[model samples]
Target: MAGGGRLLRKAFPEHWSFLLGEIALYSLVLLILTGVWLTFFFAPEMSEVVYQGRYVPLRGIRMSRAFDSTLHISFDVRGGLLVRQMHHWAALVFVAAIGVHMLRIFFTGAFRRPRELNWVIGVTLLVIAMSEGFAGYSLPDDLLSGTGLRIAQGIMLSLPVVGTYVSMFVFGAQFPGEDIVPRLYAMHILLLPGLLIALVTVHLMLVFQLKHTQWRGPGRSNRNVVGKPLFPQFMASSTGLSFMVFGVTALLGGLAQINPVWVYGPYRPDEVSTGSQPDWYVGFLEGALRLVPPWETNVAGHTLMWNVLLPAVVLPGLLFTVLYVYPFAEQRLTGEWGGEQHLCDRPRDRPVRTGLGVAGTVFYAVLLLAGGNDIMAYSFRISLNALTWIFRIALVVAPVVAFLITRWLCRALAEAEQKRLTRGQESGEVRQTVEGGYASDHRPVTRFRPGAPRRPIGPGEHTGTASQEPSAPTRRRR
Candidate 1:
């Protein structure tokens, strides 16, 4: 019972950036809540049925029962559309929060030392989150989701030897088989969400087990944490944050429209929608699929779609592999293995790492932009092929340029910080010496705790006034 009281008194560092993880946690809570509400009205079966909903356009149309129930949720159930939108928006925010949170962790080197396993868990959670999102969207069995699923099917079928087997295993037969919707619903509602919750629980336990990494500053060190207690301070703030997150998501769900399945019509094997793109998280894969040049290899009468396999399979595989390996890799590369890193490094202090992170971000951004090449080409009246070629070139070139620029910027920033610490801040007062030379007084910046109180004139802060300056340059000086 000695440590029982410590549980309620756990300290959490107070920084705006730290809220990213909290936002992700709150978003997950919203997802689970709204998702549970949805399960009551949603029918995840893929059996063929006639749509008899109030939506006039598709009233008499033939559609799957899954799509029909989605329509029912949208029209028949009270506040169903609102809950659905909130759920969708919450999912989007959840993915985004996790992304920025991970970025903050990576750039600050919070993933090092004892936190390496936590970093891996975070990466796995991201992968599962994306998979969960994919499954969630596909469950409605609408045309847009069907197209995404079709792309997924193609990606699977693009593999050389086991492609067919994989596709069959997934769809329970071939693409657009009868069993796909039910299977997707199960994964979306049951399997993926369970994994997410379990991984998140473990991530939190590890975070609590180890000391939090904070910015290096005065009164901050590896052994001690500086922040509020968990009992009232953090818990109160976190509770308010949860409501805010829920309210904002609910507002977006009610006021803003998303994934209007009825408008898109039901899934059909023969049809495709123009200018359709997957959600933003999935955009990079779509872009990669669009940008890669067509190349196929046939070995022993088996055709291999390198174009699909490379971007969709190999690229994402490598990206996630890098994520899982990065903390250990950095520790090894920096010759800091087996050393704990409790103080988070400012991005400017770690130029190589900052540059690499920027480079990877640029690479992802290029692929995301490429994902919508068709839409861009159409909207701007540009040639699709030309845009694709441009993206292909940029995809290879942009990351290198970003890396060089980021490294230079980091170095420049580091140099600037050194100068700042060396010379201190200008105190806005000009002082004249007996020799008639005037110089500005510089105040040494004693503390560097960002987001902390700056008033009350703390130690090392310049409190000198004009009245305290040497009067008449000490007229009696020899």
Candidate 2:
């Protein structure tokens, strides 16, 4: 028991900041646990089957077993709905927590020097996470997910010569197929998850090696992380929080109806809703699609595709590449040698870096909003063309504005700090009388002591003799 306790103590080391990574880990665990349970009942095969389940409304429907099993899980299986929901919610939380944690690392400049590789690993994990979500969501073969897949296919097909071949390979046929679900199932359950676990393991290992970034304060450095040790308090808190997160996710799953396959019906290729949207994480890509003008040209009897390819493949790739490269890019821009700098209480302490981050965020946000152009236009009763144009304009302008605003705010903060340093901090307000164009109640400056040695003015200077004597005496004698 002592050995076990010692091991536990050495492992966790109580810290709240450590909990950020813990949240992600816990979420992933929940996802896997719930996913394993779901896999038992879920039919990965894409064979067509008639739905004759307890849900009276959707009985006698012809659909793929994958979809049918999903429906069964939704309406028939005991607590299946809750399990499914928990799985989904956990996935969302997992992705979201990782993103926030990465951002925390970024703004604090923790990704500098020795930790740069870990930053790359983190970005790769994010890509895998999103891919996992995409593949998992598509497993049910529902309308919404199918629509998303179509967009994905469109993106895939937008590639140059190999586009059609890639799409065919991915889908296993033209559009809906018997093999696609199984392939995606393989990816969702096996490939992506394996990659995720590996990446996460590396990420954690790197974190432990690098140590946690500390909060900015006097004498505090990256090496000195502030928090309770892992033994009893951190472990207990982490365990309790994990259970709490699991419970909340379960509760939401039970109460909230998400991705109702019945409502979406089956995947239909020809039909598409006016405002079909994917989950929030992938919304930025969709926004880019909405904003880009639909243009096409043919050269040498092959289509030169810009509209589909750019938003789907090129843009997303660029975004991910930029994210992965940002730490290095920043290092290059600053020209400052890297060192451990954990605490960053003020964003303005790194003004240029902060501005860049904000600008990138603004750019992402603009693209995200642009993804829902149809919804926005329909809701506002505006022309789709106008909406697209507006987004395109905002895509260019918003980042500039965000950069300027962030820079200005940083400068203002620096100015405030400078003022604080130059003028003594006011404890309480005191009225000052205007006399000799100076404040009457100001404190007087004290002169140097009589025996204090004066600074040497030049070579052969004396301390307190002729050279140090007041010049006013000589002037008066003359």
Candidate 3:
């Protein structure tokens, strides 16, 4: 116990950006707590039953026992609605936090060298988390989830050769088969969450081993880290963050309604609610499907439905492939392949990488916007076809524009920093010499100290020493 307590002495950096990862971890805890509560009441059975619950609209309808039990939990069980909504909101926050955290890692080059495997694991966690959320909601057998399931089925069926067989195996028989709810229940509650926990453990182990990459600053060096100890400072900060996450999620659960499956009625293959959409995490895929032009090809004796194959299959594969290989790719391109990184890069200092990150963000943003095109068109009374065409064009153009602008901006900022170092800051006061020449007063801006000469450090160099004051030059007198 003494030794275990001593483990709490581990150092944790006190940076604001570092907290994003903490938010994701806290949200996962909330998700588990709320999910456990929900599990006590949620029935994943698909047996047919007449809904006699308090929800009037669904009251006389024949629905799956899973959905009926959901209505029961929502309307009849005390605090069930709160727990359910909190679970959903936490899931959203979890995914969003992971995304922002990854962006932080990317821009700061925290994914370099020893940390690359952790980056890969984080990406895997994201993918699993998404799958978990999908499975969790689908267990309720609600209309929206049913629709999503159908779309997923369609996407699966578009795969070459074994599409039909795979879909059949997944559904246990066919579309709307009786076995899917339980299967998804096992996966959502057991398989995926278990994998997530394991991966998170491994990720933290790696983090502990490698330590954190920190911003370049005074008294900090690649060989040493400076921060508060984990036992008191980090523990308190992390506890506060966890409580804040819980409070926000609980407030959202009570005040804001989400995934109102009751409003959408039970699952029906013959019926689908209009303006239906997927969760935000999956929106990009939907957007891709919507934006891809319906094109197919026939080669020899085979048919390729390019429409479904490209956006639904090829795009995601390519995206993940690129993501998995990015660190090595960037290392090779930049020829910075042989070192351990313990300091984070300022985004402006790495112009090409920063630009690439921004370009990817813009591309994703366009896809997310395209996901809501239907709602947008309806809200503004615009033509849907016209809006789709516009998004298609924007998807192609926006990333290129963003990349060029971002690269230029990074270069400009780097140049400005250089000028600031060389010329110093203007005091904005005019001074007149005895010769009647006017000059602006300025203050020297060395990185470490005021009177020291500014010397450029070599790339990836850290000497762990303070700047020396410039020696006074010898003067000649007449």
Q: What is the C-alpha lDDT of each candidate?
A: 0.86, 0.76, 0.85
- Minimum summed lDDT over a 10-residue window in model 2 is located at 469-478
- C-alpha RMSD in Å of predicted model 1 compared with the true structure: 7.8
Candidate 1 — which residues are off by over 4 angstroms? 431-444, 448-478
Angstrom error of the Cα, residue 304, model 3: value is 1.8
Q: What tens-digit string does per-residue lDDT give for candidate 3 at 1-478?
A: 8856646766666778999999999999999988888888988999999998788877789999999989988899999898889999999999999999999999999999878899999889988988998888688888889988998998988887778889999999979899999999999989999999999999999988888777776545577665667767778888998999999999999999999999888899998867877889999998999999888787665667788889889998898888889998998988888978888998888888899999999989888889899999999999999999999999999989998999999999877767765676688999999999999987755345344555544333332334332222211111
Could you say which candidate leads in lDDT? Answer: 1
The local distance difference test score of model 2 is 0.76
Better of 1 and 2 by TM-score: 1
Worst 10 residues of 1 by lDDT: 469-478
The TM-score leader among the candidates is: 3
Least accurate 10 contiguous residues by lDDT in model 3: 469-478
Sequence-dependent TM-score of model 2: 0.86
> Arrange candidates by lDDT, highest first: which order?
1, 3, 2
